[model samples]
Target: MRTAALLGAILLIILGLAQGDSDALGDDQPMFDVRKVEIAGELKYSDPNALQQYYDQLLGSGLFDDSMGNLTNFVTRPPWIESAKVRRVWPHTIRVSVVEHRPLAYWNAGQIITAEGQIITPRRLPDLPLTKLMGPRDTESVVLDQFSLISQMLSTSSLRVAKLELEDRGAWNIQFSNGIRVALGRTDILDRLGRFVAVYKSDLSGRIERISSVDARYPHGVAVKWKLQE
Candidate 1:
Protein backbone atom coordinates (compact mmCIF):
# COMPACT_ATOMS: atom_id res chain seq x y z
CA MET A 1 0.00 0.00 0.00
CA ARG A 2 2.83 2.45 0.83
CA THR A 3 4.62 1.81 -2.49
CA ALA A 4 1.37 2.36 -4.42
CA ALA A 5 0.76 5.64 -2.57
CA LEU A 6 4.30 6.94 -3.35
CA LEU A 7 3.95 6.06 -7.07
CA GLY A 8 0.61 7.85 -7.24
CA ALA A 9 2.13 10.95 -5.62
CA ILE A 10 4.92 11.02 -8.23
CA LEU A 11 2.38 10.77 -11.07
CA LEU A 12 0.36 13.69 -9.66
CA ILE A 13 3.49 15.84 -9.43
CA ILE A 14 4.42 15.12 -13.06
CA LEU A 15 0.93 16.00 -14.23
CA GLY A 16 1.02 19.26 -12.29
CA LEU A 17 4.38 20.17 -13.83
CA ALA A 18 3.06 19.55 -17.35
CA GLN A 19 -0.02 21.65 -16.68
CA GLY A 20 2.14 24.51 -15.34
CA ASP A 21 4.34 24.41 -18.44
CA SER A 22 1.30 24.54 -20.69
CA ASP A 23 -0.03 27.58 -18.83
CA ALA A 24 3.33 29.34 -19.11
CA LEU A 25 3.44 28.68 -22.83
CA GLY A 26 -0.04 30.12 -23.29
CA ASP A 27 0.95 33.28 -21.40
CA ASP A 28 4.04 33.73 -23.56
CA GLN A 29 2.13 33.64 -26.82
CA PRO A 30 1.63 36.94 -28.69
CA MET A 31 -1.35 38.83 -27.31
CA PHE A 32 -2.82 41.07 -30.00
CA ASP A 33 -2.93 41.35 -33.78
CA VAL A 34 -2.06 45.02 -34.22
CA ARG A 35 -4.35 46.63 -36.81
CA LYS A 36 -5.78 50.14 -36.46
CA VAL A 37 -3.53 52.81 -34.98
CA GLU A 38 -4.58 56.03 -33.32
CA ILE A 39 -2.51 59.14 -32.71
CA ALA A 40 -3.18 62.09 -30.44
CA GLY A 41 -1.71 65.44 -29.36
CA GLU A 42 -0.36 66.17 -32.84
CA LEU A 43 -1.22 69.87 -32.54
CA LYS A 44 -1.09 71.99 -35.71
CA TYR A 45 2.16 70.84 -37.22
CA SER A 46 2.15 67.06 -37.40
CA ASP A 47 1.07 65.26 -40.56
CA PRO A 48 -1.09 62.26 -39.82
CA ASN A 49 -0.14 60.38 -42.97
CA ALA A 50 3.57 61.02 -42.46
CA LEU A 51 3.35 59.77 -38.90
CA GLN A 52 1.44 56.70 -40.03
CA GLN A 53 4.00 56.04 -42.72
CA TYR A 54 6.75 56.08 -40.14
CA TYR A 55 4.92 53.52 -38.01
CA ASP A 56 4.22 51.34 -40.99
CA GLN A 57 7.92 51.25 -41.70
CA LEU A 58 8.59 50.05 -38.19
CA LEU A 59 5.95 47.36 -38.24
CA GLY A 60 6.91 46.04 -41.66
CA SER A 61 10.55 45.79 -40.61
CA GLY A 62 9.68 43.29 -37.84
CA LEU A 63 10.82 45.80 -35.24
CA PHE A 64 7.65 45.20 -33.24
CA ASP A 65 8.49 41.57 -32.50
CA ASP A 66 8.56 40.82 -28.78
CA SER A 67 11.83 38.88 -29.09
CA MET A 68 13.46 42.16 -30.14
CA GLY A 69 12.49 43.96 -26.88
CA ASN A 70 10.51 47.27 -26.60
CA LEU A 71 9.66 48.81 -30.00
CA THR A 72 8.92 52.26 -28.54
CA ASN A 73 12.53 53.38 -28.25
CA PHE A 74 12.78 54.11 -31.97
CA VAL A 75 9.51 56.02 -32.22
CA THR A 76 9.90 58.37 -29.26
CA ARG A 77 13.33 59.79 -30.05
CA PRO A 78 12.79 61.39 -33.44
CA PRO A 79 13.83 65.06 -33.70
CA TRP A 80 10.42 66.45 -34.60
CA ILE A 81 8.57 64.40 -31.99
CA GLU A 82 8.53 66.05 -28.61
CA SER A 83 7.06 63.04 -26.80
CA ALA A 84 5.34 59.80 -27.68
CA LYS A 85 3.66 56.81 -26.09
CA VAL A 86 2.62 53.48 -27.62
CA ARG A 87 -0.13 51.18 -26.39
CA ARG A 88 -1.50 47.88 -27.60
CA VAL A 89 -5.22 47.44 -27.08
CA TRP A 90 -7.49 44.60 -28.28
CA PRO A 91 -6.33 41.98 -30.75
CA HIS A 92 -6.52 44.29 -33.77
CA THR A 93 -5.50 47.78 -32.74
CA ILE A 94 -2.63 49.94 -31.51
CA ARG A 95 -2.60 53.54 -30.32
CA VAL A 96 0.22 56.04 -30.52
CA SER A 97 0.15 59.31 -28.64
CA VAL A 98 2.40 62.07 -29.91
CA VAL A 99 3.25 65.63 -28.98
CA GLU A 100 4.83 67.58 -31.82
CA HIS A 101 7.18 70.55 -31.58
CA ARG A 102 5.73 73.89 -32.66
CA PRO A 103 7.83 76.76 -33.89
CA LEU A 104 8.16 79.67 -31.47
CA ALA A 105 9.49 81.94 -34.20
CA TYR A 106 10.34 81.75 -37.86
CA TRP A 107 13.87 82.15 -39.16
CA ASN A 108 15.00 83.48 -42.58
CA ALA A 109 11.89 82.97 -44.69
CA GLY A 110 9.21 85.13 -43.19
CA GLN A 111 6.62 83.17 -41.16
CA ILE A 112 6.21 80.58 -43.86
CA ILE A 113 9.31 78.42 -43.30
CA THR A 114 10.62 76.74 -40.19
CA ALA A 115 14.20 77.16 -39.00
CA GLU A 116 15.01 73.96 -40.87
CA GLY A 117 13.36 75.28 -44.05
CA GLN A 118 10.34 72.98 -43.72
CA ILE A 119 7.31 75.06 -44.56
CA ILE A 120 5.35 75.93 -41.44
CA THR A 121 1.68 75.10 -41.56
CA PRO A 122 -0.79 75.26 -38.71
CA ARG A 123 -3.98 73.24 -38.73
CA ARG A 124 -5.98 76.37 -38.34
CA LEU A 125 -5.18 78.97 -40.97
CA PRO A 126 -4.75 82.32 -39.28
CA ASP A 127 -2.00 84.81 -38.66
CA LEU A 128 0.58 83.60 -36.15
CA PRO A 129 1.02 85.76 -33.07
CA LEU A 130 4.64 84.64 -32.60
CA THR A 131 7.74 86.53 -33.65
CA LYS A 132 9.02 86.35 -37.23
CA LEU A 133 12.64 86.37 -38.35
CA MET A 134 14.07 86.88 -41.79
CA GLY A 135 17.59 86.48 -43.13
CA PRO A 136 19.27 85.68 -46.44
CA ARG A 137 17.47 82.75 -48.03
CA ASP A 138 20.63 80.65 -47.92
CA THR A 139 21.64 81.69 -44.37
CA GLU A 140 18.75 80.16 -42.44
CA SER A 141 21.02 77.83 -40.50
CA VAL A 142 23.13 80.65 -39.05
CA VAL A 143 20.00 82.53 -38.07
CA LEU A 144 18.68 79.40 -36.37
CA ASP A 145 21.91 79.10 -34.41
CA GLN A 146 21.44 82.63 -33.06
CA PHE A 147 17.83 82.03 -32.03
CA SER A 148 18.79 80.80 -28.58
CA LEU A 149 20.52 84.05 -27.74
CA ILE A 150 17.63 86.11 -29.11
CA SER A 151 15.12 84.06 -27.16
CA GLN A 152 17.10 84.50 -23.94
CA MET A 153 17.26 88.28 -24.33
CA LEU A 154 13.51 88.51 -24.85
CA SER A 155 12.81 86.46 -21.74
CA THR A 156 14.42 88.98 -19.36
CA SER A 157 11.71 91.63 -19.61
CA SER A 158 8.14 92.44 -20.61
CA LEU A 159 9.38 93.36 -24.07
CA ARG A 160 7.84 90.81 -26.41
CA VAL A 161 9.03 90.41 -29.98
CA ALA A 162 6.84 90.50 -33.07
CA LYS A 163 9.64 90.07 -35.60
CA LEU A 164 13.44 89.95 -35.78
CA GLU A 165 15.18 90.52 -39.09
CA LEU A 166 18.84 89.83 -39.86
CA GLU A 167 20.01 91.51 -43.02
CA ASP A 168 22.54 89.90 -45.33
CA ARG A 169 24.92 92.68 -44.34
CA GLY A 170 24.80 91.23 -40.78
CA ALA A 171 22.65 94.03 -39.45
CA TRP A 172 20.03 92.95 -36.84
CA ASN A 173 16.70 94.57 -36.20
CA ILE A 174 13.89 93.62 -33.81
CA GLN A 175 10.26 94.70 -33.71
CA PHE A 176 8.63 94.75 -30.30
CA SER A 177 5.06 94.32 -29.13
CA ASN A 178 4.50 98.02 -28.44
CA GLY A 179 5.07 99.11 -32.04
CA ILE A 180 8.72 99.83 -31.21
CA ARG A 181 11.63 98.80 -33.38
CA VAL A 182 15.19 98.23 -32.17
CA ALA A 183 18.35 98.29 -34.25
CA LEU A 184 21.30 96.52 -32.66
CA GLY A 185 23.72 96.90 -35.61
CA ARG A 186 26.01 94.10 -36.71
CA THR A 187 28.71 93.95 -34.03
CA ASP A 188 28.69 92.93 -30.38
CA ILE A 189 24.97 92.21 -30.34
CA LEU A 190 25.13 90.67 -26.88
CA ASP A 191 26.87 93.76 -25.47
CA ARG A 192 24.40 96.04 -27.20
CA LEU A 193 21.44 94.14 -25.76
CA GLY A 194 23.07 94.34 -22.34
CA ARG A 195 23.21 98.10 -22.64
CA PHE A 196 19.57 98.24 -23.62
CA VAL A 197 18.67 96.29 -20.50
CA ALA A 198 20.53 98.78 -18.36
CA VAL A 199 18.79 101.71 -20.03
CA TYR A 200 15.38 100.06 -19.75
CA LYS A 201 15.98 99.52 -16.06
CA SER A 202 17.02 103.12 -15.48
CA ASP A 203 15.41 105.49 -17.98
CA LEU A 204 12.35 103.74 -19.36
CA SER A 205 10.82 101.79 -16.51
CA GLY A 206 7.16 102.73 -15.89
CA ARG A 207 7.72 106.24 -17.24
CA ILE A 208 7.65 105.97 -21.02
CA GLU A 209 4.36 105.52 -22.87
CA ARG A 210 5.34 104.46 -26.38
CA ILE A 211 8.76 104.10 -27.98
CA SER A 212 8.83 104.09 -31.77
CA SER A 213 12.36 102.76 -32.07
CA VAL A 214 15.71 102.31 -30.32
CA ASP A 215 19.11 102.35 -31.97
CA ALA A 216 21.68 100.30 -30.04
CA ARG A 217 24.11 100.29 -32.99
CA TYR A 218 26.19 103.04 -31.41
CA PRO A 219 28.81 102.16 -28.86
CA HIS A 220 28.27 103.48 -25.28
CA GLY A 221 24.77 104.66 -26.10
CA VAL A 222 21.27 103.68 -27.22
CA ALA A 223 18.90 106.01 -29.11
CA VAL A 224 15.20 105.95 -28.30
CA LYS A 225 12.30 107.26 -30.42
CA TRP A 226 9.00 107.95 -28.73
CA LYS A 227 5.87 107.33 -30.76
CA LEU A 228 4.10 110.45 -31.96
CA GLN A 229 0.33 110.79 -31.44
CA GLU A 230 -1.53 110.73 -34.74
Candidate 2:
Protein backbone atom coordinates (compact mmCIF):
# COMPACT_ATOMS: atom_id res chain seq x y z
CA MET A 1 0.00 0.00 0.00
CA ARG A 2 2.91 2.44 0.79
CA THR A 3 4.44 1.71 -2.65
CA ALA A 4 1.12 2.55 -4.38
CA ALA A 5 0.85 5.82 -2.45
CA LEU A 6 4.45 6.77 -3.45
CA LEU A 7 3.61 6.16 -7.15
CA GLY A 8 0.51 8.35 -6.89
CA ALA A 9 2.51 11.18 -5.29
CA ILE A 10 5.12 11.00 -8.07
CA LEU A 11 2.39 11.21 -10.73
CA LEU A 12 0.98 14.36 -9.10
CA ILE A 13 4.42 16.02 -9.13
CA ILE A 14 4.79 15.17 -12.82
CA LEU A 15 1.40 16.78 -13.57
CA GLY A 16 2.46 19.97 -11.81
CA LEU A 17 5.65 20.13 -13.92
CA ALA A 18 3.59 19.71 -17.10
CA GLN A 19 1.30 22.55 -16.13
CA GLY A 20 4.29 24.86 -15.53
CA ASP A 21 5.66 23.94 -18.94
CA SER A 22 2.35 24.82 -20.56
CA ASP A 23 2.36 28.29 -18.93
CA ALA A 24 5.94 28.94 -20.08
CA LEU A 25 4.95 28.07 -23.65
CA GLY A 26 2.38 30.93 -23.61
CA ASP A 27 -0.76 28.86 -23.08
CA ASP A 28 -3.48 31.32 -22.03
CA GLN A 29 -3.18 31.78 -18.27
CA PRO A 30 -6.14 34.25 -18.36
CA MET A 31 -4.71 36.63 -15.74
CA PHE A 32 -1.25 36.89 -17.37
CA ASP A 33 -2.52 37.29 -20.97
CA VAL A 34 -2.26 40.79 -22.47
CA ARG A 35 -5.79 42.21 -22.73
CA LYS A 36 -5.13 45.72 -24.00
CA VAL A 37 -2.61 47.50 -26.21
CA GLU A 38 -2.58 51.31 -26.43
CA ILE A 39 -0.70 53.11 -29.18
CA ALA A 40 -0.06 56.84 -29.51
CA GLY A 41 1.44 58.75 -32.44
CA GLU A 42 0.76 61.15 -35.27
CA LEU A 43 0.74 58.53 -38.01
CA LYS A 44 0.88 59.72 -41.59
CA TYR A 45 2.48 57.00 -43.72
CA SER A 46 2.75 53.99 -41.46
CA ASP A 47 0.06 51.35 -41.80
CA PRO A 48 -2.46 51.50 -38.97
CA ASN A 49 -3.94 48.10 -39.73
CA ALA A 50 -0.56 46.41 -39.51
CA LEU A 51 0.04 48.08 -36.16
CA GLN A 52 -3.25 46.77 -34.83
CA GLN A 53 -2.58 43.28 -36.09
CA TYR A 54 0.85 43.20 -34.51
CA TYR A 55 -0.59 44.16 -31.18
CA ASP A 56 -3.45 41.70 -31.48
CA GLN A 57 -0.90 38.92 -31.63
CA LEU A 58 -0.05 39.75 -28.06
CA LEU A 59 -3.61 39.20 -26.87
CA GLY A 60 -3.46 35.51 -27.75
CA SER A 61 -0.18 34.43 -26.16
CA GLY A 62 1.39 37.43 -24.63
CA LEU A 63 3.67 39.22 -22.22
CA PHE A 64 4.29 36.00 -20.33
CA ASP A 65 7.90 36.08 -21.48
CA ASP A 66 7.96 39.16 -23.74
CA SER A 67 10.27 42.03 -22.90
CA MET A 68 9.66 45.74 -23.45
CA GLY A 69 12.71 45.81 -25.71
CA ASN A 70 11.05 43.48 -28.21
CA LEU A 71 7.89 45.56 -28.27
CA THR A 72 9.83 48.80 -28.85
CA ASN A 73 11.89 47.26 -31.63
CA PHE A 74 8.79 46.04 -33.46
CA VAL A 75 7.20 49.51 -33.55
CA THR A 76 10.38 51.15 -34.80
CA ARG A 77 10.92 48.68 -37.65
CA PRO A 78 8.82 50.72 -40.08
CA PRO A 79 11.00 53.06 -42.12
CA TRP A 80 8.72 56.02 -41.44
CA ILE A 81 8.93 55.61 -37.67
CA GLU A 82 11.90 57.58 -36.44
CA SER A 83 11.70 56.51 -32.81
CA ALA A 84 9.45 54.69 -30.35
CA LYS A 85 8.73 54.43 -26.66
CA VAL A 86 7.08 51.42 -24.99
CA ARG A 87 5.67 50.77 -21.54
CA ARG A 88 4.18 47.71 -19.91
CA VAL A 89 1.50 47.83 -17.26
CA TRP A 90 1.49 45.07 -14.69
CA PRO A 91 -0.93 42.18 -15.49
CA HIS A 92 -2.18 42.93 -19.03
CA THR A 93 -1.54 46.22 -20.83
CA ILE A 94 1.11 47.77 -23.10
CA ARG A 95 1.44 51.40 -24.22
CA VAL A 96 3.49 52.43 -27.23
CA SER A 97 4.41 55.84 -28.61
CA VAL A 98 5.95 56.39 -32.02
CA VAL A 99 7.60 59.34 -33.75
CA GLU A 100 7.40 59.42 -37.55
CA HIS A 101 9.85 60.92 -39.98
CA ARG A 102 8.89 64.26 -41.52
CA PRO A 103 9.52 64.05 -45.25
CA LEU A 104 11.32 67.07 -46.66
CA ALA A 105 11.64 66.01 -50.30
CA TYR A 106 11.94 63.10 -52.66
CA TRP A 107 15.48 61.73 -52.77
CA ASN A 108 17.13 60.04 -55.72
CA ALA A 109 14.33 58.21 -57.51
CA GLY A 110 12.95 55.75 -54.98
CA GLN A 111 13.66 57.16 -51.52
CA ILE A 112 12.67 60.13 -49.34
CA ILE A 113 14.74 62.69 -47.49
CA THR A 114 13.57 63.75 -44.05
CA ALA A 115 13.98 67.25 -42.64
CA GLU A 116 16.73 65.79 -40.47
CA GLY A 117 18.53 64.62 -43.65
CA GLN A 118 17.75 60.96 -43.08
CA ILE A 119 17.22 59.04 -46.31
CA ILE A 120 14.56 56.33 -46.04
CA THR A 121 12.98 54.02 -48.56
CA PRO A 122 9.31 53.49 -47.83
CA ARG A 123 6.76 51.14 -49.36
CA ARG A 124 4.94 53.98 -51.09
CA LEU A 125 5.75 57.52 -52.21
CA PRO A 126 3.84 60.57 -51.03
CA ASP A 127 1.62 62.43 -53.51
CA LEU A 128 2.72 65.84 -52.27
CA PRO A 129 4.35 68.20 -54.73
CA LEU A 130 7.74 68.05 -53.05
CA THR A 131 10.81 69.10 -54.99
CA LYS A 132 13.16 66.32 -56.02
CA LEU A 133 16.79 66.31 -54.81
CA MET A 134 19.47 64.05 -56.29
CA GLY A 135 23.10 63.27 -55.53
CA PRO A 136 25.42 60.31 -55.25
CA ARG A 137 25.09 58.00 -52.25
CA ASP A 138 26.11 59.48 -48.89
CA THR A 139 25.58 63.01 -50.23
CA GLU A 140 22.05 63.48 -48.86
CA SER A 141 23.17 66.01 -46.24
CA VAL A 142 25.14 68.02 -48.77
CA VAL A 143 22.27 68.13 -51.23
CA LEU A 144 19.68 69.00 -48.56
CA ASP A 145 21.88 71.81 -47.19
CA GLN A 146 22.29 73.35 -50.62
CA PHE A 147 18.55 73.09 -51.30
CA SER A 148 17.82 74.93 -48.05
CA LEU A 149 20.24 77.74 -48.81
CA ILE A 150 19.08 78.11 -52.42
CA SER A 151 15.42 78.05 -51.44
CA GLN A 152 16.05 80.67 -48.77
CA MET A 153 17.89 82.89 -51.28
CA LEU A 154 15.11 82.60 -53.82
CA SER A 155 12.35 83.18 -51.27
CA THR A 156 12.15 86.84 -52.29
CA SER A 157 11.67 86.00 -55.97
CA SER A 158 8.91 84.22 -57.86
CA LEU A 159 11.41 81.64 -59.11
CA ARG A 160 11.28 78.55 -56.93
CA VAL A 161 13.67 75.65 -57.25
CA ALA A 162 11.70 72.67 -58.44
CA LYS A 163 14.63 70.31 -58.79
CA LEU A 164 18.25 70.32 -57.62
CA GLU A 165 21.07 67.99 -58.63
CA LEU A 166 24.70 67.66 -57.52
CA GLU A 167 26.87 65.88 -60.03
CA ASP A 168 29.50 63.38 -58.95
CA ARG A 169 32.11 65.82 -60.31
CA GLY A 170 30.98 68.44 -57.74
CA ALA A 171 29.00 70.52 -60.26
CA TRP A 172 25.54 71.72 -59.29
CA ASN A 173 22.48 72.62 -61.37
CA ILE A 174 18.97 73.75 -60.61
CA GLN A 175 15.65 73.67 -62.43
CA PHE A 176 13.33 76.51 -61.57
CA SER A 177 9.59 76.11 -61.28
CA ASN A 178 9.12 77.78 -64.66
CA GLY A 179 11.08 74.94 -66.35
CA ILE A 180 14.28 76.98 -66.80
CA ARG A 181 17.52 75.17 -65.95
CA VAL A 182 20.61 76.96 -64.58
CA ALA A 183 24.14 75.60 -64.55
CA LEU A 184 26.15 76.73 -61.50
CA GLY A 185 29.32 74.83 -62.58
CA ARG A 186 31.88 73.45 -60.12
CA THR A 187 32.96 76.54 -58.17
CA ASP A 188 31.58 79.77 -56.69
CA ILE A 189 28.10 78.18 -56.47
CA LEU A 190 26.65 80.80 -54.13
CA ASP A 191 28.18 83.65 -56.15
CA ARG A 192 26.83 82.27 -59.37
CA LEU A 193 23.45 81.75 -57.72
CA GLY A 194 23.41 85.36 -56.52
CA ARG A 195 24.24 86.56 -60.04
CA PHE A 196 21.52 84.42 -61.57
CA VAL A 197 18.98 85.71 -59.05
CA ALA A 198 19.88 89.29 -59.87
CA VAL A 199 19.60 88.69 -63.60
CA TYR A 200 16.39 86.76 -63.16
CA LYS A 201 14.75 89.53 -61.11
CA SER A 202 15.98 92.38 -63.30
CA ASP A 203 16.10 91.02 -66.85
CA LEU A 204 14.53 87.55 -67.20
CA SER A 205 11.49 87.81 -64.95
CA GLY A 206 9.34 89.41 -67.64
CA ARG A 207 10.43 87.04 -70.42
CA ILE A 208 10.88 83.87 -68.35
CA GLU A 209 8.74 81.69 -70.62
CA ARG A 210 11.08 82.25 -73.60
CA ILE A 211 14.19 81.28 -71.62
CA SER A 212 15.63 77.76 -71.89
CA SER A 213 18.80 77.76 -69.79
CA VAL A 214 21.26 80.13 -68.12
CA ASP A 215 24.99 79.38 -67.88
CA ALA A 216 26.17 81.18 -64.74
CA ARG A 217 29.84 80.07 -64.90
CA TYR A 218 30.97 83.40 -66.29
CA PRO A 219 32.67 85.76 -63.83
CA HIS A 220 30.96 89.02 -64.81
CA GLY A 221 27.85 88.02 -66.78
CA VAL A 222 25.55 85.05 -67.42
CA ALA A 223 24.78 83.62 -70.89
CA VAL A 224 21.08 83.02 -71.47
CA LYS A 225 19.80 80.45 -73.94
CA TRP A 226 16.41 81.04 -75.46
CA LYS A 227 14.08 78.30 -76.66
CA LEU A 228 13.62 77.72 -80.40
CA GLN A 229 10.50 79.24 -81.91
CA GLU A 230 7.71 76.70 -82.47
Evaluate all candidate structures by whole-model CA lDDT and list the values in order.
0.66, 0.84
Model 1: per-residue Cα lDDT over 125-185, one tens digit each: 3356766767876665666656568778768687777777889889988776766677988
Clashes of each: 0, 0
Q: What lDDT does candidate 2 reach at residue 213?
A: 94
Q: Tell me the TM-score of model 1.
A: 0.54
- Model 1 RMSD, rounded to 1 decimal: 9.1
Model 2: residues >4 Å from true position, as ranges? 1-31, 54-61
Q: lDDT tens string, model 2, 1-230?
A: 99999999989986776576674544436435577788798888878877677666667445556676777777677788899898777656877788899999999988999878888998888887889999998998989999999988888888888899999999999998799899999888889999999998888989978998999999998999998999
* Predicted structure with the largest lDDT when compared to the true one: 2
Q: What is the C-alpha RMSD of each candidate to the true structure, in Å?
A: 9.1, 7.6
